[model samples]
Target: MKYSTSPTPSLNNYPRSTSPLPAPANYQPTTASAAVKRYKYIRRLFKFNQMDFEFAAWQMVYLFVSPQKVFRNFNYRKHTKSQFARDDPAFLVLLSVWLFLSSICLGLAMTLTAGKVALFVLFVVFVDFIGAGVVVSTLLWYVSNKYLRRDQDGPDVEWGYAFDVHINAFFPPLSLLHFFQIVLFENVLFRETFLSCLVANSFWLASIIYYLYITFLGYSNYGKLVDSDLPMLQNARVFLLPLPVLVLSYLATLAMGWNLSEMLMHFYKMRVLQ
Candidate 1:
């Protein structure tokens, strides 16, 4: 009986195991949950999860202490779109109240009449706070679209982002200086004299530089999404857009103050003559 040796069954032809495979040796089931918990804790600690008075206070303080960090860490696409200036009136309201109070304090310190105090408060809220922001952001949007195009097909910069940048950049310096003008400075003379105008202009110029710095960081971070290049020339172009806006705002505020002073002085002179 010559039985030929048969070849062993190939392993490839065998059916795969139906049993569930074990998890990998390095895999831990808690890793993802731990990461999520950590993220939520951070958000809570930083007050990013809530939009309230505390968050507004944190934002204002953080603007003065670590402005670059604020811009760098901010999710522009998420927050700018969702909690925009229009959506959240709390910040503006808070700002208006602050300016109103500051104006009242300054006017009282200067011994101004009731009507003058009311006028000053209105000017601070309407003109300095709201009006300046609108004008500057609009001009920035126009100049950015016109001169700062990354390429022919680059995305047009949104007005909201410009407004965001301007607010964050200008708020710190303006608030700090205004506070100093009220509390520290013996006399509150914004544009009454040449020295006062120089001081105010210097602060405004600082704000312009800070604005440019924050804008550069923002562009560098989101350049890819915006189709923008972070070249020096492009940065310079973006910087130039805010320059005129800042200067114009400064001049306009100065001119307004000067004219108000003149009118008041004229009225006082006429009263004295009587």
Candidate 2:
């Protein structure tokens, strides 16, 4: 007689595992509102291992030389992910790191006390960059959603997207004002001569222009993405309206013997050392 056969165990016959599955390493909660998404982003600020800093560095580079390419990728993101603004906060994190290091370098270049240097870094990272960025982003978010949209019935711009645009535009200016200016300050741009004014004002001029160009690109790209009634970038030139006025102001500063770089240094000293 054959041995009695035992019934084989089946996965279905066995109770299914009741434990919850872990989310993806790159999991994003797209269904959340902008505020909730921002809270999540803020939560990830300290999780360095989860960040995509390599891509953030690439964004920093392209944001300077070929911002068009950067925005092109934003378009692709919209098509693939159903959003134009970045979900990853890696760029913001990397920028903060860079600003901290640059602020330290600036303090060293200026021969600042350690306490002063620390204070300066805090001021730049928290007050100048983040604080100002929040205000500017809020203003633009309100303005763009309220006034710039071609379709009032369609979806309005996200506040996070406005902040993303602000940070994107802010990066190039930070490199110029915070990094490159430190290099020039030891010998050249710190002088009180009219030539110093010319150089310093030129930096401001270039910074503002870059900021406007990137801002224009950001809003214009959004307009194009939304399939507006007007042609691409028709109203985007509004960002550039300040250019001619900026040039005139630059010339006026030169005429008036205003060394903006020196003024900026003094402002920093007053804020930090005092």
Candidate 3:
């Protein structure tokens, strides 16, 4: 009996089956493209998560030292968005280390020059630089985030985590400067020279005004994601909202010091008149 059998399969021209199809030929993934693709995917998946404070802190420190980075991101939309998204705890910790190191070095330098009149001037100048830092920190985030809004896909919201991160990181520098000006100077340098006290007074006054302005601005615009959403600046009195009672309380203490000084001067004048 002749049984018809299927023609023997030929090795040539027959499709070879493997465990799985090899990745397509002509699918060339260069490193740059892969990185870019990865970045985009990560950005979308990113959330403030539990690490938001840490991320935001690093961003503040990074942007503080490298204004150029913020500026570049301002010009480039992708960078701004990526930056805003990846803000996480690990990054903030690194930044805190850097800011802490910076603060320590500044404090040490101040310590080394503790008793010198020239040191007082340097301290005064240093305080001014600290004030500048505050302005720059606030400005970099405000501007970078503003630029990010240009092509935003959804409603703009303040990354509260980032804002908090910044506040936490920023408070250190501000507090350090305040300590140097108030306690350090008052205890050591103020009695040395009239000029020293005058400079310290100016620094203190400037600091008070600066703090009030920044605090007011922070609360007034705290939840405002858009410019139009801002309450009328004149009518809103947004400044009163952030409980600056602590700051106000501090101011009251200073006022009492001034009043006591005035009373002493008045008593001295009466004695001379008698």
Candidate 4:
């Protein structure tokens, strides 16, 4: 359902205003309790052209730091998305395959190390998957709320909010996880299989750097490669830029030195494996 707040602000003839509007005293940040409420909140904001880079930036900070309000402000029952890319189950299947393959290869390598460090890397992989799950779910929820029934002056709610939350949540964990996973795989596998690990590592590194570049410099660089722009970059920044977050999350897992998988495996081996 399409819900409009104020009329669309003119993007074509945007007025040059030096000052941004001060946040209203009553304006408190919050998250949506359900996907539908989040949809309406974003839809209303985008429709009024209130959804912009500035708003997106703040939203990212709020999501992690103060999620309750962010969720609460969302008008749950009235929310709906005009379209959802994941509605195509084929795409979700492809994503699951890609994620599973990436995780397993890394896990196998870490297992071969025959040391506590290798075990640690395996734990990182598990956390990375969990983080990725959060990113995908949150973004999909927001995307479904976007009103694509008609074009407006600004981005749809999906573009403005979905990408932001996804990137912010996923990036840090994915990056750090990739590094350890690749390292363990290389050490365990013979020289022949090293090339596959290398290739995956390169892709992980490249995606992270690319994510950062697109954030600072517009995604136009991507347009250079594909001869067309990819909206993922712009839409994603509306949250925390998922790449960096995924990268950092990996680092955090490593720093903590918590081998979640090993712990679970140990418990299972003792309780069930025997």
Candidate 5:
């Protein structure tokens, strides 16, 4: 967070990097399918020394404050490594660790038993984060290549990149609903008053909004590389297809007097109980 007396590259035309990052060791700019790249990426999971966690931490910080700057690196990766998906597993590893820690904190705040807390953490880290991530990423990957792309012959959106987008978008929401929401859960969000419902659901609304915006940003920048001639691309908000439905759902939740945080607490307890 320290200001440096250094000039960084401008974010305009970032996808076309003027100063690309130095490629990782053993990296080569080659056109490869996401599946193949994922195979190589997974192999490095156990190798702790090669991961750049400091850079990952920096990226995480910017993701909250200035997500645009964070994604500029993704474009740089494509410039140097021929793919938008990251090669290092450091970010994924850190996210999982954060997810685990946050889940524990949430479970404890809910006053669950130690065994139940363990079960809740397991469900969150595995089911909510990893399992659901695969489904969302695969769905977006399919949609981008099928409908979003100009044609079958054009460069397809990589599946790994779709997953990256999902995780990148997922981080802020997780911090909001999991970390920040839980911090306020015991005092504010778990109540049954109208204010409680509004505040709790507002967090839900904001979290989903953050997710959608970041997801759109991920695809929007990529869309610039592909054919942006579609009539929808006239406005800069071309990728925000879900905002209306999201707003409607948020309104419905408020009208129904649902406390989303309380619901989350009950859901976690139910998951552990069963």
Candidate 6:
């Protein structure tokens, strides 16, 4: 009855408010905060927690003291299915520390200027990280998935699984050698001696062999999809699966001219001021 003469209140009369809402008291700008958060995230990403440290230590012991146990007990497929789970980060952290220390020791041995030493170490680490960690790992995964898959019949092995197996099998011994090279053989006489080089190469070769053996075991457990009667062929195929990685590693080293002793000597000769 009150609307008798009034035009029906049109919906258009209720104009919507365009004013922006005030920022919440707790809502801080994400610009600096986002960067800080990202920095923290990256730091945390690379940081080794206690669990990681303990696992890495245990891995070293298992790899060095009882490699067979490692192959027998460690389940590569189960761990690697989730990509970068389990010992992946641990291995990376260990490798990074090893690389850093080894580079420092090598720089000192080479008597290089501090700047040169830093540059050289950075270069070597960069090259190695790219070559072994990225390129060779990718190649191994491809070879395993594309070619080696035919040899096995179990679950379809993912590239991450192969990559994990490769890293675990290879890096432990390598890291040990890196430690030894820096700690025990830092002197010029040791660096120059043929025995030292021979021993180093011998250990390197042994590590490679051990990696192949571990990879063989991993394949035996996960990759072998064939009938029970053909176990030998399955074994052989698994054994050979890592050959591609080996070849790639060798090629990479050659291409990069990555000789630890040479690198040490090159820097030593620089004799850059401290």
Order of candidates by lDDT, top first? 5, 2, 1, 6, 3, 4
Write the residue-wise lDDT of candidate 6 on 58-177 in tens digits.
766787677655543343322223212242366556767777877677666656678888886776577755456667667656655566554454334444455656666766555645
Candidate 5 lDDT over 1-274, as tens digits, reads 9898888768774543344333232133467766788888999889989999999999788888888777666765764678778899999999999999998898889888899899899899889999999999999888777777655664677778899889999999999988987776558776779889988889889998888888887876662322222311123265577789889988998899978888878877887898
Instruction: Please give the CA lDDT of all the candidate structures.
Output: 0.54, 0.77, 0.40, 0.39, 0.78, 0.53
TM-score of each: 0.55, 0.83, 0.33, 0.31, 0.83, 0.57
User: Between the candidate structures 1 and 4, which one is better when assessed by lDDT?
Assistant: 1
Model 6 ranges with Cα > 4 A deviation:
1-51, 72-88, 150-154, 186-197, 223-274
Q: How many residue pairs clash in each candidate at the backbone level?
A: 0, 0, 4, 27, 0, 4
lDDT of 1 by residue, 82-169 (tens): 2112233345445656677766775675567787777767766778667998898888667766776656464455565567667776
Model 1: runs farther than 4 Å from truth? 1-50, 76-87, 187-233, 236-274
lDDT tens per residue, model 2, 68-145: 878766755654565667868899988888889888988777779898899899999889998999999999888877
Model 3 residue runs over 4 Å out of place are 1-98, 109-191, 225-227, 230-274
- Residue pairs with colliding backbones in model 1 are none
RMSD (Cα, Å) for all candidates, in order, is 14.6, 9.8, 18.3, 15.9, 8.4, 17.8
Q: Which window of 10 residues has the lowest lDDT sum in candidate 5? A: 225-234
lDDT of 4: 0.39
RMSD of 6: 17.8
Model 2 worst lDDT run, 10 consecutive residues? 19-28
Question: Judged by TM-score relative to the true structure, which candidate is superior, 3 or 6?
Answer: 6
Candidate 6 clash pair list = 110-268, 111-268, 153-225, 154-225
